[model samples]
Target: MAAQAKRIIEDAVVRKDAKVGDKLLDKAFALAFKGLVYAQIWEDPVVDMEGLEIGPDTRLMCIASGSCNALSYLTAGPAQVTAVDLNRAHVALGQLKITAIRHLPNYERFHRFFAHADHKENAQVYRTMIAPHLDAESRKYWEKRDIRGRRRISYFTRGLYRKGLLGNFIGLAHLFAKLYKIDLSKVLEAETLEEQREVFERELAPVFDKKFVRWLTSQPASLFGLGIPPAQFEHLAGDERMAEVLRRRLEKLACDFEIKDNYFAWQAFARGYDRSESAPLPPYLQRANWETMRERVDRIDVVNANMVHWIGDQAEASLDRFVLLDAQDWMNNAQLDDLWGRITRASRPGARVLFRTAAEPSLLPGCLDDAILSKWRYLEEQSADLTRRDRSSIYGGVHLYELA
Candidate 1:
């Protein structure tokens, strides 16, 4: 099984020139991602929505990490949205969301199932309302029992936010913070940015700079929870100490974004959503967007496939908005060119492409074919601006590219 999983990873690597070590590392990443990586998409949808400027005419394509953003895009009234992920688990999760949106009785019930996300009744909601609407594969993925005799869907009832690889990683981070006598959750109570900064400096910063924390972050395995592949780790960790890099990013997460409405910041500091704090929820989960989401839910198609191949088969000039969301950081030069080739082929005139990277500045300048690269105008200033506003302050950069 392990060998087969490794081969799957190798075959999925778009770059033919990927080194053996890169291939092995990608295999580990693929294996981990296949299980359950993100329960919630981390890239700030607010930042992405601002960049893409989705409209009724837009046809969207994205790498569906957790499907939260793709579903969120539906609220923008795009003509169509298709999300592709190599991980079946993610695809299944997207499918389940679609099912829930379509069949659930109301927004309150839906919010309780996902955002509140920890009540035994959620399983009953799933079996009675959501399960019947799901396709066979998604249904099987959620309904299948684990060794503990618990159905995967039961995670919704046990705090779904605390479950995936990213969630567990945050939980570990909180544990480590506690070891240093710091309670990271206190960052949530700060009513102002200054207060947030003060709290972070007084509490979070000292613990983060601790020797044990620094050493743990320096190791590659420590970041697997962030869904970061070895290649991405190398990209983000270049020259600088990983501890410092993390501290800078965490500072932005804690201080730059207001805790009152920044759910991403709340999640980072508290390891859970601030339900009573007026912290804004993802658009898909917001009560106001439910009607739009339900009306357009049919437009979202979830596919489990390699993104490059999926984009390759797409019709010319059909897609208008592309959200890569840090996946390019995992690609080598050849893989990047291949992926961009497909994007260029599938993009309509005036298509806007948005992606994030683990390092500042876009990766396409020297890596992709000049012909294809020249056809898109890099929105450098806007990307820089959006990166600063990105509530999920984990990425080193946010990039926007528009067909020229």
Candidate 2:
């Protein structure tokens, strides 16, 4: 499974016939991506749910990054969510979350195991309660030792959010801030948007302009932690310096929303969800929605496969919604055509497709074949609205398309 997963990721990321330098970077990205990457997906599920307009009858298909969106979508009562991913660790993580939800005794335990994610008792809880019910593959994945020689399950006891590639990337960012005597967490102390903006402008924004920070951001490999491949890095930077682009995104994350209501901010600044009782959380982790997620968790089918290939196998007009995340930024024109061709075939009438991009404009305008692209209409105004509302703030665009 591990070998096959690596191959699948390479197929999606590594472009053959590219220049030598680009090919090397792509290969390095594919290799780094083979292990655990996103312990929690970066996309905002609220914006996704709004864009997709999920319903009770909705049959959704999505890239199951960390499976957070898949589980969160259950709150809308989708009939089925087929989540496909090329990473086996993500597949295992998805399966584990579903199994843990079903097997864990109550909401508090479930919250601690996932939300708190640093309780020493979590490993014991998994062993005594959740492990027996988890599938063999997921169980083995948790039991296996990581490169650090510690069992993978020990992450929950230490800090699950601080373990994956993104986790380490954020850790590095914090370390750089520390080197400059800046506290990234200071943004979290602001109680109002005004104060948030003040703190960001005064503290975090200047770090991006530093000589060392600008040089670091200029390297394509520097953002591997955020899961941005070399190709996507080009799109993300566009005409600006990479540091400037990053500064803009970070500014939005810090100032666009209130800290009290944006869990994404907490994750970015504090490296975990807020611990306060009234803290905002992903829909799946919210106590009020816990029962809904637990009841509909079975509706999610996590598969270790490429999404386009899996959609190609589904019956025509069978799927009601699709969530592509920012994956299209990683694809070439031909790959995008293939994916949209299958998506067009599989989409039901009025079916919605939601995806994010590294740039402000939609990638489909000239890249996707007209035959497939014309079958759907882009919701320009609605897309703009959701893009602004996206608390994650990592993406440049959050686009929506509906079958027309």
Candidate 3:
């Protein structure tokens, strides 16, 4: 068992070898992203907020991925936001944005900071304008010299935020498709609705029909790059009928979307998006919302630790909402219980939690049901709406809960 276990849990012990780790990147499906943040665009959280019937005074806590939606919450003008994550890299990503918005003279500068992130000049600007705002840890992470011996700040010299973890995984999946002789990237560049229709009809549809794609779709390990753990894969889609459900979901992703309006579709087809002032923007990107953003920016807080430890620091009934992004898939029962228990303890009378999953079903009901899990009401209809509208066509499921 010990030797078998060694093979099972070696991911953490192994240092990243681009040569070897390249093969294993998507195996973990860990969530990592940076710019043009699109987590759940179509879900329109504001609409969901309306459904939650939360008040203007509501203070919420959520995982700050790409910080887009978390910053989007500021548009609702929530009183406070406490963002938590175990990934120092992600926390670094969030802190970087919050600091940039406040310090970078204007939106163009701001855009440049992230848009042309692969540049060196951005580092100098960061060291001068943004670095002072960051904590020592983040400053260290960004300031640490890159392989070029140029500081990591050099990455921003041109201010383009490149393909991050999620972006990279999406790219890797594309390469895998190519290695396997499939091409999803070309689908994104379809110039017109007619072109897109043709591509989907020809190239995209075959991925679902092919034997290898079908086999890969059926395997739990293959979904890791999308952040589905083996347990979560089993819990969500591990059933005997999983292949059918997965096929249905993938089909929906390929065909159930309108290329023009669907941002998730765009991300799937193109690794990135075409940004414009009038474009369908995310909550965090809307310029008019910045004043409200500025006022509430100070209200947002972050913890450079795992959620369990962070939740421990909150007092009973101290929080109003929670956003645990697909991270629950990575946790076991005891960890889940500790987290939910703390969340339960810290929640107010009508607190709500927003979460996503790699599979259709949620990870909570088994442990957090009505009798034992009676403290929360799963907002199923609202969750469905969010899932349907989610601009980041990444996850298979979305869920919402109101504390009982």
Candidate 4:
């Protein structure tokens, strides 16, 4: 099944390279990520935490996932930001966020544009207000028709949250429940919060405990779609029952954060974050002083490039913050060397580099010899506390590092 999924992806994406921009392997990487895990369903608050060092002089680089985090970063006064992504869909989404924040008449329209993403009026609003600002490539990407022959932005029209990888996976799980004589759709239809909690506990909880289901989860290959590589699978199970580990993670994803406050958790369970006039905070959800954040926004420049390729393109010691989002797992040592080389060059004194991975520690240790990596201060221990508190604690760790 993994092999088949890979082939399907290669034909549809890697070979087509339909979403490839800036031609960094990240298009390839994005496809790979999509094949293994869901992309762009919700913003991970951890990424926002990793990227946010908001101040007048701060500049940051982060993955453009649906653009929510990008604007959330805008709330912080940073000199400039360079949002990058290989997925054209995500780029279009990010471009839309940038456009909406700058052009939407006020917070109300902006709220409607996103929080209530399914409104049919959004397409018109997007065309009139947000679409014009998008770069040609990104514009075309979102405007293009999907397999269902619907405009891509139509994904926002209904099942707004059901459009991303995680959404699709949950959808599949619901379908799977049908095979087991479970009516997941009915469970999902619980409209009230009390009903949702009751249904999740009573109806959905049994599937995880079935002997057959638990047996299937024992294999690493089964969860590749969730982007659990073999190494990550080991870390996740960690001497506990696979069911228990998932329970712990899901509990973290669902329960650890406040219901109204945690956007990541809301997106995971409720599809969209919130459906009200005033919405919940997004991952990079800060805008403390708009004047300062606006000035900071002006100072940033966004480019399309990957770490290794772009590092090769730059002279040394240039960047203050490097945001890597679990791409290292897809790379080899040479790639790591090149990427770190670029990090080494692009980094300024006191620069802090942040990234997340499937495992509990930095992907840098074995790939980057102690000789070279030693120069960079590992904030692993320092970040451990924050990692414990991350919204997507489904994975193992959130790591922070500072360049010496």
Candidate 5:
């Protein structure tokens, strides 16, 4: 089974006859993604849910990253949500979260486990409550020890938010911020948007101008922690300095929304959610939605497979909504067609597909088959509006496409 999973990824590396540089870069990205990557998702679920407009009859399909967004989607009362990922660690995390939601005693306890994310009791909760409910695969994955000889689950008790690839990347950024005498956590304390922008311009924005920061951002490897493949890096860095792009995105994160309620900003800057106001919590972790989420948690089915491969296996027109979170940025033209082909086959009438890109324009025009592309109406205006409102502010564009 593991061999098959590995091959599934191996098979995804198209351009087999490409130049040495491309091949080497592809190999590096595949290796980086093969292991545990995102401990927490980077996308903005508020923007995603708004764009999706999920309802009781919505059958959503998505790439499950850290399981945060999938759980968030449940609040909209979707009839079903199928989350597929190439990473087994990601699938395990999704499954563990679902299990925790179903079995945890209350919303506070749930928050303590994920939001607080470093309580020793979290490991205890896992042993007594969460572990039993996890499948054999997830159980084994969490039980596995790290290089420090601690169980991977111990992250819950030891700052879970600071452990994964993305987490460590943010940690590195914080270290750089400290070097420049800028405290990132200050953004979290700002009471309003103007204050947030003032703090960012005063403290955070200057850090990007440092030579060390600029040099680091210029390297493709520096962004691997953000789960950005080298191919995507090319798009983000095109005709502009990578540091400049990063600074603009950071400005958006720090200034575009009120820091008190934008949990994405809080997480990026402070490494955790706003503990004082439960309203800032992810939808699944919020008090009011916990019971409903708990009831609806069973609707999600986690799968360890490539998106196209998995979607191809489902019945024709089985899915109603597709959340392809920036995965298309990594694909070549042929691969995009393959993915969209399966999507067309698997999508029901009126299905809406939402995806983000590392670059501004949608990836479909020159890549996807025109006939297949014709089946969907690109929601260009709505996507642009949502892209500006995305509090996460890490992506270049957010796109929505509805089946025509």
Candidate 6:
């Protein structure tokens, strides 16, 4: 399974004809990505739902990163959600989340297991209550020991949010901040946007100017933990130095939205969701949506496969929505054409497709063949609006398209 997962990722990310340096970078990214990457997906589900117009009739196909958005979409009562990913670890994580929701005793247990993820009882609860209901593959994944000889499921007890590539990347960022005598958590204390801006300018913004920090950020490999491959790194940097681009992105994350309302910010600044009952959380973790998620948990199907291949097998005009989740940033022209071609064929009338890019503009117009691309209408104005509202602040643009 691990070998096949690596092949699938390489097929999607590694360009066969690329130069040696590019090929090496892609290979490195695939290796890093084969294991757990996103402990919690970074995209804002609320913005996703708003952009997709999710409803009871919506049948959505999304890339299952951490399964956060897929599970959250259940709250909107979608008819069905098919989440496909190239990584087996993500598939196992998604399956585990679904099983846990179905078999866990109550909302508190569920809450404690996921939200208060550092609690000591979570692993035991998983073994006793959740494991019995899990499929063998997922069960084996959690039971497996890491290089440190710790069972994978023990992450819940020790701080699940602090594991994975993204988690460790944030931890590393915090370490760098501490090295400069700046406490990143200070941004979390701001009560208003003005205060947030003040905190960012005072405590965060200037760090980008440090010569050592700028040099570190300039290396393409430095962003591997953020799931950025060499190809996407160039797009993210564009004409600016990577340090400036990172500073702008971090500024948005810190000052553009209220810390109390942005769970993405909480994860970035606090390393987990806020513990308060009123703390902002992804839709799947909110108490009001808990019953809905539980009731609709079975509506999702998790598949470990390349999304393009999986979609190719589906009947034409069958899917109503697609959430690509920055996966396109990893693709070359041929792959993009193949993906959009399948997407166009599989899309139902008025079907909406949503995705994010590392750069501000959509990557489609010039890259995808016009014959296939012309069949979909890009919602330029609405896409720009959603981009501004995305609280994650990590992506450059949130794009939406509809079958024309």
Output the lDDT of residue 329, model 5. Answer: 84
lDDT of 2: 0.93
lDDT winner: 2
Candidate 6, residues 154-256, lDDT tens digits: the string is: 9999999999999999999999999999978889988999999999999999999999999999998999999998889989999999999988889999999
Model 4, 1-404: lDDT tens digits are 33443443333223232234423343343354542133343336545454445566766666555555555565555666777654445555666666566676665566566665788888888888878776786677678777689887776667556766556766666566777776544433455556645665776677788887898788765665565444455556768778766755665654455555566655655556555534455633333333333344454444544435555565566566766766565555665676677777777788877666665666788887566688788876666866777766666666778877
Query: Could you give candidate 5's per-residue lDDT for residues 1-404 as a string of tens digits?
Result: 66776667666743476788877877776777766788778888888998898889989999998888998899898999999998888998999898898898888888889889889888789999889888999999899987689889998899988888888888988887777788777888788888888898898877778888899899888898888877889888889999999989889888988876688887888887777864477777788888898899889999998888888898998889999999898788888989999989998989899999988899899889998999999999999998998877899999999999
Candidates 5 and 6 compared by lDDT, better number: 6
| Tens-digit lDDT track of model 3 for 60-85 | 87766566667777767677888775
In lDDT terms, how accurate is model 1?
A: 0.85
Task: Kindly give the stretch of ten consecutive residues in candidate 6 with the minimal lDDT sum.
Answer: 1-10
Q: Please, what is the whole-model Cα lDDT of each candidate in the order they appear?
A: 0.85, 0.93, 0.62, 0.60, 0.86, 0.92
Ranking by lDDT: 2, 6, 5, 1, 3, 4
lDDT of 1 at 357: 91
Model 1 worst lDDT run, 10 consecutive residues: 1-10
Off by over 4 Å in 1: 1-10, 13-23
Residue 388 lDDT in candidate 1: 87
Alpha-carbon shift of residue 94 in model 3 (angstroms): 0.9
Each model's TM-score, in the order given?
0.95, 0.99, 0.78, 0.78, 0.96, 0.99
lDDT (C-alpha) at residue 58 in model 5: 88
* Candidate 6 Cα deviation (angstroms), residue 282: 0.2
Angstrom error of the Cα, residue 3, model 3: value is 24
Question: How accurate locally is residue 257 in candidate 3, as Cα lDDT from 0 to 100?
Answer: 58
Candidate 2: C-alpha RMSD to true structure equals: 0.8
